[model samples]
Target: MKTIDLRSDTVTLPAQSMMDAIASAQLGDDVFQEDPTTNELESLAADTMGKEAALLVPSGTMANLVAVLSHCERGSEVILGDQAHTFMYEAGGISAFGGIHSRQLPNQRDGTLKLEDVESAIRQDNVHFPPTRLICLENTHNRCFGMPLTVGYTKSVAQLAGDNGIAVHVDGARIFNAAAALKINVKELTGSVDSVSFCLSKGLSAPVGSLVCGSAEFIAQARRNRKALGGGMRQAGIIAAAGIEALKTMVDRISDDHRNAKILADGIAEIDGLSIDIDTVKTNIVYFSLKRLEIAGEVLVNRMSELGIHFFELSPHTYRLVTHADVDENDMDEALKVFKKVMADL
Candidate 1:
């Protein structure tokens, strides 16, 4: 049987057109900002996000890292959802390398931080308290079954942040998914935040690259921070060329991933030993639980892997499945068969 990898959208391989673009891309030393293809990609990314400028980085981690460094000073604090990729997945770069403090609040199941909680979390001018300098949000929030945050909520948060003289940053790694789901332009989602970092490697099907978009002055500072973190790359346009195509062609098709994810979630809900909230299977991510069963998630994962189906076990009894450009209806059908067989044996 062929492998059906639903581990994450990041597992998607570059398309043939992307590979072609990579081979023929114009190249130059990016340190001096002479790479035409890189410059074009950055410009396009900035415009798409409605920002004054953008900086390309090696990964979503690096993109968020530089954005954090740009927005906050040493010993300052940033407010974020406890389940946010920045607060949960990132390796404490903000606190460790930048001396920034993180203040985390519980993320609602729908992937939003309570405004009242945010208001209460802001530090007053006590000399001993760290000032809150930034507020971070994730669109298509990863840990929340990839729920898409709305423009109204984002704007409200931005207004609150502005009232407190704080900047807002969005970890929009799968922002296009959010846009496609909401039937809104990408700018509607990004305009409220001060900066946004989005990935081309995820559902976009690019081999690698993420872009950080923000004000021209902010990007100028972020570019310096990228170098401080050893992120400067030479002849990077080869990879950037694929990113350019990803933006041009790969965005609209993400709707198909969303549909496939719902189909997988619906099928899982029908399985006797599994449970899922089909409504929460938004965008490309579907999270399900085997908690009702006697089997451990790891064992079930292993059993499914043997059948050429792969995904991540989020906890001892929970698993996460992500649909992407590569996986289709046929792949989901095959995966469902494997799931049923594995459950029967259990």
Candidate 2:
């Protein structure tokens, strides 16, 4: 039986074109800025995000960390949502390595921090306060039902940050998905921010890589931070080539993943024991919970896995499924059937 893994977009394997690019790519030491393929990818990434320059890093976490390290001095603070990936998932790298402090505000259901809340969270000029140096936002926010932060909201945050003499950075790991779902140019989502980091691995289907885009000065600083963090890769064009291929080919089809997610969410909503807000099926992520308290999420997950359909049990009752390049509409339909059978049997 074929296994349908809906755990995350990060699970996607690189396409054949990406593999071919990797095999044929020219290689040089990226640490010395001599890798032509890596340089080309960085240039392409910056142009795509409408930024003056870009730096390639190993992963999205490093991209965010490097961005923060470059933007603020030690002991400065950054404002972000409580549910943000950087706050919740990055394992305190910012504070551990950079001595940066974080002030987390409540996240709206649509994955935005209220402007008033953000403004209030900014520290007053006091000897005891950590100066707020940056504001962070997420595009296609993962924990909030994959909500895409709108362009207008981003501009508002950027404006507020600018007025307060603070910088803005976006943890845009799945930003391409956000652009596709919103039916807008990706640049519009990123134009106002001081820096934005996006992943080529997730949704883009590259083997590995993330790019941080910003002003040339910011990227030069970020590049130094990357080296300090031991992220400087030699002969990295072998992998960067795949990233170049992914950007060229994989962006436009993300809408198909969004469509599959809606279909999957609609199917889950129709199941007797499963519950979901079909309206929140915005991009490729579908989140649902069990209305039948008697059935544990792990039991359902394990049963579905036994049937070759795999997803995540986020909690005892809550579950998540992500549609990616590897999973298709037929896989979604089959998974729904298995989900129904498992719930009924349990």
Which residue pairs does candidate 2 place in steric collision? none
For residues 1-346, what per-residue lDDT tens digits would candidate 1 score against the true structure? 7999999999999999999999999999998999999999999999999999999999999999999999999999999999999988889989988999999999999999999999999999999999999999999999998999999999999999999899999999999999999999999999988999999999999999999999999999999999999999999999899999999999989999999998898899899888898889878999999955566568988999988999999877889999999999999998998999988888
For model 2, where is the 10-residue window of minimal lDDT?
292-301
RMSD of each: 0.8, 0.7
Candidate 1 runs further than 4 Å off: none
Task: Tell me the deviation in Å of residue 105 in model 1.
Answer: 0.5
lDDT of 2: 0.94
Model 2 TM-score, all chains together: 0.99
lDDT of 2 by residue, 96-195 (tens): 9999999999999999999999999999999899999999999999999999999999999999999999999999999999999899999999999999
- Pairs that collide in candidate 1 are none
